[model samples]
Target: MTQAATSDTNVLDLSTCDSEPIRTPGSIQPHGFALSLAEDLTVLQASENLAQHIGSAAAGAVGLPLARVIGDTAAALVVTELAATRVLERPLYLGTVCISETCYFDVLAHRYDGVLMLEFESVERRASADFRNLYPLVGEFLLKLNNTVSTDAMSALAADEIRAVTGYGRVMVYHFDHDGHGHVIAESLADGYHSYLGQRFPASDIPRQARELYTLNRIRLIHDANYTPARLVPAINPVTGAPNDLSFAALRSVSPIHLQYMRNMKTLASMSVSLIVKGKLWGLISCHNETPSPVAFERRTACEQLGQILALSIESREDASELQFRLDLRRIMVSMLGGLTQGADFIDNMTSVFPALLTFARASGVAIVVDDRLLTYGDTPSDEQIRELVGWLSIRAHGDVFHTDQLAAGYPGGADITRNASGILALPISRIHKHYLIWFRPEVIHTIDWAGNPHAKEGAGPLDQLTPRTSFSSWRETITGTSIPWHKGELELALEFRTALLGIALERAEQMAELAEELGRANKELEAFSYSVSHDLRAPLRHIVGFSDLLLESASNEDLEKRHRFLKNIKESARLAGKLVDDLLSFSQMGRAALRPSTISMNDLVHGCIEKLAGDTHGRDLRWEVEDLPEVRADASFIQLAVYNLLSNAVKFTSQKESAIIRIRAERHPHENVFHIEDNGAGFNMDYVHKLFGVFQRLHRMEDFQGTGIGLANVRRIVERHGGKAWASSVAGQGATFSFSIPKELPV
Candidate 1:
């Protein structure tokens, strides 16, 4: 046998296919009855051969009077023989039946007044071990076949495998249009055979009656189309009064006309496996054989297995498509969430990241819907258009995906209006009530090589429609699943993200408003504090100066001792009180001043302080030990004040000493700048060092070391304002080191 054989040669058999376990014909006689499903599962066609074998009188006479023809006596024997499996019904059954020439027929009995052929083929009495192991294996296989990435690929692959398995010359994947017509979407043909890859067939060929019967059972085989029996119709129908139609129950047959049509196409013995979906016939597996041959019971059984695999694969593919869709949406949502920044700039940049989303919700053009009315369209519609659309959508907007194949008569329920709207996708898009997003597609007279003509589809009267939708009467019904649908979750999520941006913007604006208010309050308080210092505290200091001066003036030169003592005490007390007031002012000012930091040389500042003090003091030998003070970034005036105060205090405290030692030095450390003013003079106890930098907190009495006590506190405030620290280490009567820090770095 050639690896690849032509359709004109000997018939190529797949009975020994290496890809699958081989199955042969059954032990029972090959001769059997025929049942072709059709006409709402009720119409059963029984052949004359079948009628006679079942002990019926005639062909057409048996169908209309089935209970009478397949009599209770024969029926009882048949039912009793195959009673373990199925339940006889008004036209529905669950299991198979066996009918051989020897045993009295029990399983298949027909009751009809309809348009299809219904029969129960023989049930396998002795189940094989190979068949027993198939349940779980096939279940798992079906489960996996449904999970393939591309449903189209799975469909094609299944068609190829099924053709090989069933010995069919050509196996095709057929997709049924809404009008019940079918198109061959994919096909696997024998070498040299012309393929029907994209052929279209009308619903009239299959008829409404033929498609309805596919659901009762799935596999159909017309082994010999030219010779099979025609169904027996007792009176043709209820109107035809007399013995009429043929009985085809026993013999497998096809119509002469259909046979001629097949012969014209150069094919024979066509068999199809129904592809049922969501309780409707979506399509079928159509197979054709060029040669006259019988697809025996064993081959039919094998084909059944392959058909099951195809069903499982299609279902799995559909499920995967849905799952992938959800995952993609979830990922997009997460990305949109992450794009939220402090401002809309983050979101703006993210638009390019997902350029396709805005169009996910595209329109032929968009129209805004308000109050169940059209407000504006792709570029804002006129008042007339809005009113018209609103009226149309108002009638259908209670959570339904609406479409209009023909709007030549305008919207439904409102007469006297005419317009051609080839398609409409109106989704109520609004966070609030009475607003919507409507999309419109006008009849563009585009070419559609479909039912009516293989040319442009032009707009016409109300009856004109497209493929799968023959006329306006069945337009909506046929296009039930065709639309750019709005998912509830997706719409809600988009709204939520848009709202979240506005929320962030609002929060930032609120923060700015609050900061302005606080700034205004701070300005008013500083003004009040400055006023109090200038007015209330200054008056008392002025009085002290005047009275002390008068005391000095009134005393004569001879009373020098008493006058000197009184004036000294007055000046000292007044000076201290004045200093106290000044310190208070400085403390208050520190809080208001913004820190202006800069690099300053401490050695220069120290020298300057010493020069000013030296101008006031007479010559007294004092060695100044000033180290190489490094530069520090700090407020210049503040650092000067701190150094001056420390140096001045040291000068005063050492006035009584014979030789004063005052030192200004800086030590470099890894993290901070440290400056120390060490003086050998009066120093306080280590325990009193804690009070060194506090306001008006002095460890030494005025009689020993004089100070306003605010100097160290001022130094602490200044250093801290520059984000540094100030502290003093002192020992009683030995020495004191007043150390402060200037931080090394700046804040953001």
Candidate 2:
């Protein structure tokens, strides 16, 4: 055959091997012959070796009913069996049929690409084996498989069991890892047979098309690698005008390169059974022989059954293991939530669960970042590196989590921290705050034992065809700059953790929002206070000017009593104006003051404020009702000022009463302390209550209640500074109650 004999018409090289069209090689192994027939049993194409296998008439059978070549009885069996099968791309046995007086063959039929492929293998070659005798072998394998526990153990058991059934020189269980690289996990070898037990094979060893074929055809056998391929009479199918899809044909010839690969390995025959788990080709059970060996179809069927059973076992074990791993992650997530709800800041709570966090995703390190604050645990990169990573994460991770096992491939800066952080799983705790919780995995440096140096390739073959590697010795490859790839389960757990972290972060963010609002309110009040101060101060200055001008006018006509009265009035007004100026300065200072909280007895604090006001209340008929007050955590000086303002206002407002009554008490709730001051005074109307807490906002006439309105504003500011609140409730003529609340736990 010339190079033009292959449909691809390209020399097999590293660049074109993947597209080699191994499925449509247009030939069959010389041990068995294949025929491409139309739907009505017309022979569209026949193998060239039909004359060697059957007779000269069979060799020229194309464009004729298959009954004309193989006798009517044999062709009828193929037609009847295919008529009963519904699913396509799977071979159905037609049993043994005699094409002539001496030509007896076992036939298999399958449909693909609108054509029926019928493959024939000589039954005389089998000494005695058939399907009826293979059941006990299957039953015995099942009984021992129940004793196996781990995946490795089961793989070893399968390799041993398959070798015993097939009598292969070497049988290996090759498992594919997450990276699509295969490694020999278990092996059974005969005497003088080489072992590939611990070696790895790159994914390129089997090109993409070959793996696809394995998925469609679960078992493939090459009886003799050195046999010349018997070419089909018509290279392309007449119906499709393309190469017939021989994907399901048992006798389909494999790629010449693969045949060369086997020759280089010093093997004459090979068979492979695919291990498909959950509808995906997971690995293979590879068998090789040192001589031209052929197993009966019955034994091959038994091996196929074993492969199915092995696939199921592997799926069950992997599912069970993943389930347990997810359950473990759930427990760690529960512990993390417990810590987060302890009323500390997000960083502190996350740090408290650092050990569990590391174990949560099998991470080597973890980092919690909120705003500009960063906290790290276990093995970690430098602070600068983490911050840089956070900056990058902030752009992509809006509300979802992001993860990558090959961090350096996606993030250039990651190359510098391969030792500490080759993999990263980052969850955005709060996008608003630029907050994140990240887990890190360090680079795992290990060596791979390849069957040969994968990169080593020799010059082209005699006809410019790429040759297979000559050596099959173990070659060690030391890999670097990559961590163990994160599995689907781990990525799922990270998303779950993200959901939980968002909840805690949202709660903390709400508190921050409240603080922001308070600051905004303070700013507005400051602006209003500035406007009201100038207006109120101008009135006092106007009164001083009016009295001094009147005194000056009366100076020329000075009666002694008028002169004395003017002087007294002038001096009293000057003192009142000075007092208002001092109060305004104090109010300004209170707004800017920082809170220094300590434990204080509300009872003692209230008593101190009342005693300070005793001089003004000494001559009045005043009654003081003091209820027991609770101890609170607050700044002593600030609380005292607030309490003084409330008590002093109570005293002045009720001075009109013949019998003045004042009450002070406190109440404690689960989260805050509420204090109230009630007075039986000439209370103001509730219509204008909103103005009660504004700076210099007076609800009553100045002549009726002679006091600055700055007191309540000052009280509100002091209370808010400690993350508390203050308010008042009143009736038109009865009395008023002033109240304030302070949180049990302060904000940081």
Best by TM-score: 2
Query: Over the stretch 1-748, how does candidate 1's per-residue lDDT look in tens digits?
Result: 1122455543223222222111111011123443322323222334445544554434444434333444544434444543454433222332233233343321333333333334534333433113443365456545656565665666677677667666778888877865566776778988877665665555654544356555545666665555544334332343233332213222223334345546655666777777776566777888888886655344455556766667666666667776776667667755655554434343243344333333433334555444543334343345576566666676655553454545444555322222223445555434345455455444444221233322222346332231122211111112221323345445554555446545654665687788787577456545644554564345446656766776768666577776777677667667766776777778778868877888877778778888888864568878888888888877788788888888887887777778889988888987788888888887878887766776556677655765555677778878877778888887777778888888888443
Give the poorly placed runs of model 1, Cα more than 4 Å off.
1-55, 58-77, 86-153, 164-166, 175-185, 191-193, 198-268, 276-282, 290-302, 344-748
Model 2, residue pairs in steric clash: none
TM, every model: 0.42, 0.68
- By TM-score, how accurate is candidate 2? 0.68
Candidate 2 ranges with C-alpha deviation above 4 Å: 1-15, 57-59, 79-87, 125-129, 389-399, 406-416, 430-434, 458-465, 511-748
* Tens-digit per-residue lDDT, 150-235, candidate 2: 88888889899889889999999999877678999999999999999989887878888888889889999999999989888888
List the lowest-lDDT window of 10 residues for candidate 1.
Answer: 20-29
Q: Poorest 10 consecutive residues of model 2 by lDDT?
A: 1-10
lDDT of 1: 0.56
